[model samples]
Target chain A: MALLHRRLERSYSARSQGPLAAHARTLAVDAAERLGRLQPGNDFSAPLMVAVAVDLAQANAGATARELLERTLRLEPDCEPALLALGFSLERAAEHQQAAATYGRLVELRPDHHEGRLRLALNLIRTGRRPEGEAGLRGLLGAGTPTWVATLAAQELVRLLIAEERLEDAGEAARAALLRTPGDQRQWILLASILHSQGRRPEVLEALRALPAASRGVAPRARYSEWPDLGAAASQSRLGELARGAESRLAAALVEIGR
Target chain B: MTVARCVPLLALALAAAAPAAGADIWVTITAPREGEYAIGEVEIAAEVVARAEVAEVEFALDGRVVGTLVQPPYRLRVDLGGQSIAHRLAVTARDAEGGQATAEVSTLPPPIAADFEVELRQLYVSVSRDGERVLDLNGADFTITDEGVEQPLVTFARGDIPFTAVLLIDASGSMFGDKIRAATAGAATFIAGMKALDQAQVLVFSDQLLVRTPITDAKEILAAGLGGTEARGGTALTDSLFVALQLLEERQGRRVVILLSDGIDTHSVVDMEQASALARTSSALVYWIRFARDADNPFDDGGVTMTSAWRSSQEYGRQIELLTRAVRESGGEIIPIRRADEIAPVFLRILDELRSQYVLGYYPDDRRGDGRWHRVRVKVDAPGAEARAPRGYVDD
Candidate 1:
């Protein structure tokens, strides 16, 4: 095995030896320190040090882990793993402000890094800076944002609006998600449910009708909003027919949730 | 090995020899990673090192026995199901000397399977007239209908039935300060009321399960577990409820889930519908002790009422609707109190009601496990005799 990787494995093995392993923490700390002192000539030194830091954090030596993370960051300021590990350790300790600052640094370093920005926005919300966090979420839902990140941002923004009693805005946000990510079907369920809650029957029917049709002859269960089959339920002939002819708009919207 | 190593080894030996004190068994779970969404056949592996000769390790799903391991690598693989739902795994280890120790871990609750059980259903019914409980009713005195079809009772028991309960206290960030203290006191009151034969587990959850004691009749142990908890997360009410049902699903006899919360769920992946389905599946009565957010306008509290619906998040309306409906369908009641002080009294009152309730079980005539909601109605024949039972059940 490679020398650094072998040391890493041995360090972990020492920690998990048993309850009687009194030197487990000390051994782990020593291993991390030794790895940190490794010459910078080895290309894997930085990443390996970051891994040892994460292992230290998991072993409950978080303070020592932070020290190692700092050393890694000093050597490689743009180290993504080191930043994320440090931020996550802080977040786990409920130090949301510190975590947010760490994430902010990562975001500044890599503006287009979707995960970094997402973590930053989440930490901002956790630190009680709701308005800025809400704005951050909104900014991520633009044209270039990945589908996963946009979906998450949309969910968070709508949740915030809903918490603040801005139901109409939440509905709009859900609709915005549908628009931003074209051909995305999941948002349609979210949009229909939001509209159904607001009693927007026409729009509810329109959203449900817009759902993708691919299935054959599946029936609609009475309760659709209860989280029906995921994906497009429009293929269910009964659902489409119900959406068109059902007297109750809420009933019609629920019918297509068979997806 | 140095003397430093020998000291820890000696301590482990001592800890292992301490049998009756329950200090010998040390269990640390290594699998079913907490934050990861686990589905299909998830492995439940734990590193258990005991002082005594390790006899066997038993793993349970909810309270149901899943599997037992007699050797090293104390692990068992469990099928959580096709859909991701909140699953609580209880692992109990028994040494050769008869010493036993147990620990519990819960999977991150996910959106559940939309189905119900077709087995024998137990309904915990409480009858009252003029705000007084009429506890002397028999099986002959009551008539039950499933989907409007009259069904014969398979098992009927009145009072004296020992019940297992899970007291769910919401220790969210909003529940900080006096709210948490009141909740703790209330939980203590419920634990104090449990009979020596009755078993209960206290689950204090915010975004995570902060305190979870095993099902025990020891009041001091239950009360001690209630202390030192800091309220600091969003309320995961639905997920917590689903966890409660999972914890109670395997326990025999009558089961009760008493929830104390001041707000709608803000951090749960498991929605109310899935929780509702699980409630019906388990047949455990769910009592929600809601502390009113607004004293003056009760309807404006928790965004549950129709008047309050337009104000809060759209999802809250459905959550409150489904949550309240699910509680009622489990034949349990919701008590809303404006003051934090009313918490203990409400908890005591629910405990009293549980002691006086009647349990009826029946095999549904509709044998087909058609995943449809059934309308169930229970009636009493005597004059002014009001019977409170589940409104219906979902026959999955």
Candidate 2:
């Protein structure tokens, strides 16, 4: 359909700033007009409408886009792209629970969808279902998922394990993620922080220095404000407190070393 | 007679045992599946299975009743704070017929504690006096502030640091013939100027993007990628820049995007606002190269005329303005070329400035990583000398 082509072009343009972005915007406006003539339940019209809504969402009209996407899903629940877009929009609006539910349903509908599973796992963690979330991430890695997905899952697993004071497990998970994307500075920091917690100051310094010098200075854009304490989960475990203590000690060390 | 009596007795016993229907009810705890929770509002979801009409569901933590729900999807939110220890989470479902079922789960909740952390912010500073770069400025010669509060410089490194750059060339229909060739040559010149540790990727965009070369320091690879590129299709400069930003997001060291385009946005889904947003937030410096052939002479021959392209519409002017703003916000420079030969020199000049610029790192005086934008101003001790640094950063 003309609407479909225009929508696709508009998607491309929205990501690009070249001449095509303006052209795509104009074409999408025209396509939106023609879209009304098409009947609902035409198999393609629902997606087209969803596409129009996506274009609007890119323009910062997320609420309008969310309504349109919901309407389209009301008619056809199997629209994958629309469902994904809706989940992302919900996330942008800080509706984490709704986004998690949406992604949960998406994973249920398409059991083998990597992106859906990834989003579902992350949202579950966000909603404080750490065990289920960790299981989902582990499952993805064990199922031979894409490298990027596996990398992301491993990274999240490290954070979850660290929050539980499972230092050895966190180190293992961090190492796995690092092997996949050595360029990710956050993973390096996670590893370094873990080492610092075990009284292994030399190992912590080694881990920090192992990272590319340029990336060593960088940190994740977001972090958990609190660190978990040792033996928090198990009564007989030998862990101390969360990684924050180590982070403080390390910060002082860094300042002392003056890199 | 004895056999018939025994069969009747067995049937009566079975009937008595199965006397009631629709009398069972059960509840199950769905969240905190690992029996552990992070320190925060923990959402407890419970599902009820009942053969009879359900009256209500009661939620409890550590044997104390917290709240009751009379809905299909029984749920409750409990603030689990004060200590990092294990507690019992329980739920009970009661049927209208007085039958009840209970489920309990033990979970270790995270302790509420504060993390003393610092984030090191990197700023690439360029100092110029009368259009020439000044590279000898030391850390003492520069003063930096965030939101008007002075920050101490903790890390300072300059020159010989590895750089990562992306050569974004426009191969749109309007840039046919000599323009594409000159752009390719200019790109090759830029790559040749890089140090052994530096890497660059070449991306040519028309309506779609083509990877001329992956990120590499090898000269042969750079040549093979930039060579044999032709102009076709519509321009998608914004898309290419967005892609460039994404590619450089996680890379280490100085990130730069050398964008060579005619300043005309034709066919891109991304508008100026989005581009500007990325530009404002990106750690990468964007150098926009706008090529025009003799704006003063429209009747000249023997070369492609880019002056006509700029003079054709107001849209062109707007596009140029957008690019200029992006450059300024990114603390980068925009060079307008009047001849094809100027392209190579401009590329070299950018490389020179990049190599000679100063790097400053400091932790914000305001250590609260509350995700707020803090404006940064870098000042040089030299009088009449202007310094360019990142305008601001979002603390996280």
Maximum-TM-score candidate: 1
Chain B TM-score, one value per candidate, order as shown: 0.66, 0.64
The collision pairs in model 1 are A229-A259, A230-A259, B16-B51, B116-B396
Residue by residue across B1-396, what tens digits does model 2's lDDT show? 112233334434332122123436556677766456433235677766665677888988778786687876676655443234677888888877787877777786443344655445678888889989887778898899989998887556565456789999988767788888888999988888886657898888774565546677887898788877878766657756766775665565578999988766654434455566667766788888876634675222233222211122344455556777788768787788776677888899999888777877776667576757778899999967789888887665
Error of 2 at A239 (Å): 90
TM-score, candidate 2, is: 0.42
Q: Which sections of candidate 1 miss by over 4 Å?
A: A1-110, A113-259, B1-118, B301-312
Candidate 2 residue runs with Cα over 4 Å from true position = A1-259, B1-116, B293-320, B367-371
Predictions in order: lDDT: 0.67, 0.67
Report, to 2 decimal places, the DockQ of model 2: 0.01
Candidate 2 lDDT (Cα, whole model)? Answer: 0.67
TM-scores of the models, in the order given: 0.46, 0.42
